[model samples]
Target: MVIINVLKIVNWFRVTNSADLRKYDFSEELTQMKVMKLLYYVQGLYLKLYDERAFDNDILAWRWGPAIQEVHDKYIGQREIVGEISEQDLADFKEVNSDERLAEIVEAVNEAMGNMSASDLVRKTHEERPWKETEQSDVIADDLIKDFFDKNFKVSRE
Candidate 1:
């Protein structure tokens, strides 16, 4: 019989400590964590949206090794899969080709990168959420959030 620890496995985060990722000058550390967390969430959402066992499971530009030799792979390219995200696809998203099955995955990746410069700006400012219940002198935060959403989405049907 196999056993599993549901509590320990839930909401688990895979950590990546690349020195290359840390080199960029940060205005605040928490801001950087926020963007990276969003990226992580988006990737998880992508995997959830796709069926890993179906034939012709195209993973777009997700990267994995040529040999199916590792358990810890990008997964999209491991089983019932083909191709990872390429450099050109990373720089220019117009190259990504998809069908109905991959629709959500592509959309999530786009959302992850969309208005990304703003997130980068947020990172550079180093402003973090206050730990205490304190009022802010700047009353424009509400406006800023609204503007951020509006500028990013092409259509707000909701």
Candidate 2:
């Protein structure tokens, strides 16, 4: 089934960039409390996965869904507070943000435009994460995905 096939993918969204994690003015904003709460959730789950050595090597995809998105939803804007795409009309974010999930990223963008303070998993806090950094993966998953198709879904070929 697709569930088993999908399980072969190790999926998790995290902002491993030092710069990206430091954009938020943690000391300057009180509303940051909400963003911090979300980080605790994302990081707490990540620590569990890291300790167990789980979700390694693409075997198990830690879903890039609502969980980490709670933190990621902070950087997006409705009409773009950054002079770029506005969140109110954002469709896909992956094309704009490198190695970032589109769904959650756009949600954050939308919220930012709405004047709601929130952030995505790739926080602007500047902290060390327990799990492996997503940015360190030199190759883009797209090419790998193309290879996956070329080999007819054989995990051994990967």
Candidate 3:
């Protein structure tokens, strides 16, 4: 349920940000690959800043990059651009929208990474310590991501 909720929030972002992303050439046709990497960065940065993971799902080192199995399966052949979230769930998870710091992190990642092609995103994730250390299909530990981002980015956990 937590993963579903997080997926909803992330997918909602993909949908809502399509217009603004156009200038960066990351229009509405966001690929599954791009979405997954964006989610991974969001999780990593959120963990770095807040000392907590944004989602409960394990981020696995899939062939391409970090991915959530359930979310991956849901969008295997999806071309809908964005996944749906119930109004009640959206209302209940106000923090996904209202947390100003989290919003900034999400926007920064989306803006920075959104225009990348799927292959480029895959390569970028592969360079990440968590993904590199993990074997294919293995879970990328949240602590690893947190430690890497904290050390490399010097992001204050304020």
Candidate 4:
């Protein structure tokens, strides 16, 4: 179960990280800090609407804000995001693409949060409940994220 879960996260990281980099035209300016924070927002919004996590990995409360340790490690020491979306990763998102609502949610998240600077995103997530309730380096709970988005964003919990 654990290994299966880890592989799911790995594929999600490949798809999302690649999408983000492509959105930014693969600029050297895109850093790990920006990618991690954008991922938190995407995950939070997905949880709000779907009542489940967007990615399979744990998002830990880091000094900056919510950070996916796996994604962080993948881009460690890289100035710009560098990765290839595997055939499996493509297939996974292809499944996701069949769900129009999920596709819109992802597009909305990227459009809204993609342009923000890394520092701005960090500050915003710092004020959000999931990160605020977690101790440094602790995993931010899914329930906290769902509750925050549901209450604050007016997303229906039913």
Candidate 5:
């Protein structure tokens, strides 16, 4: 049912943005908070553009902002996430890249917010309807996310 594992999404970001393959130069390092926000945006934007969830993981309205619990737990205590890409990660990255639209959504989000500070991203998400409407620690529903993005985010599906 889950279209993609959340870790796979993390891996996609890690592998694609590595020195060998990184297309753009991002000065800020990738922190856990930034990753969490990126995931939130990717899911919401993908739902807006494609009428579906990018990953099935429930994004909760945490104190900081939108967060995937599993991902947060996995990277807890780590300020910077620079893990090596596993074989599975590479394969998953390839699969994600194969889907042109999905890849575009992911890349667009990374380009847009990848260098933003964690606090900036948190403020941005908190301003958004999906995060604002959801109660603290409550799961931000896909419908709310989709509807918010549908009305606010303008993109070309062509």
Candidate 6:
């Protein structure tokens, strides 16, 4: 079962990025690396929290970190995602955000690591087993992500 829709999640980030810039006063817009890393963390956290895979898409271990090819392809040649969120994009984001659990997972990930730089997220993922063990360009298995998060991830309610 496809628990998470990758495009919807991406739209969520795009929409949220705009809001976050104002809410948090972020100087830089979300880059591709930052979005990918956030997606990876959301997938891992969802797996740990729900004992299920978030999305059906395979996450590849790229030179930077875990990356979804679809995302990379979409944002290729873009330095930072800076644009108006279209009506369709906003609707798609609303669809994703309607799922309370999934929205919470996304919110938690953003709150925890959204402020971190792309390089910081890359370094953090590189230290994790899924990225470290998977060969470059190979898919980082969901089971590996689940296992690693089960052992290493700690939930905080604050």
Identify the leading candidate in terms of lDDT. 6
List TM-scores for all candidates, in order.
0.23, 0.20, 0.78, 0.72, 0.88, 0.92
TM-score of 6: 0.92
- The TM-score of candidate 3 is 0.78
* Per-residue lDDT of candidate 2, residues 1-158 (tens digit): 01111111101112211223357554222122333333333223322322221122221112221122222344433222122333322322232333233224323433332232445342322232222222442322323323333343221211
Q: How far in Å is the alpha carbon of 69 misplaced in model 6?
A: 0.3
The local lDDT score (0 to 100) that residue 127 gets in candidate 3 is 86
In model 5, what lDDT does residue 141 have?
A: 94
The C-alpha local distance difference test score for the whole of candidate 3 amounts to: 0.73
Candidate 4 lDDT over 1-158, as tens digits, reads 11123334334444766666667675334467777776777678878887776668889999999898888777678755535667877776666556565556656766677677788889999888899899999988988988888888744322
lDDT of each: 0.28, 0.27, 0.73, 0.70, 0.85, 0.87
Candidate 3 clash pair list:
none
Stretches of candidate 6 exceeding 4 Å from the true structure = 156-158
What lDDT tens digits, residue by residue, belong to model 6 across residues 45-64?
Answer: 98898887666778999999
Among all candidates shown, the one with the greatest TM-score: 6
Poorly placed runs, candidate 5 (over 4 Å): 20-26
Q: Which regions of candidate 1 fall more than 4 Å away from where they truly are?
A: 1-42, 51-95, 118-158
By TM-score: ranked, best first: 6, 5, 3, 4, 1, 2
For model 2, the local distance difference test gives 0.27
Quote model 4's TM-score: 0.72
C-alpha root-mean-square deviation, each candidate: 16.0, 15.8, 3.8, 4.5, 2.3, 1.7
lDDT of 6: 0.87
Candidate 1, residues 95-124, lDDT tens digits: the string is: 222233333443554454433443453352
Tens digits of per-residue lDDT for model 5, 5-120: 88888878777666433455545557788889999999999888778888889999999999999998999899877567678879988878887777898889987887678899
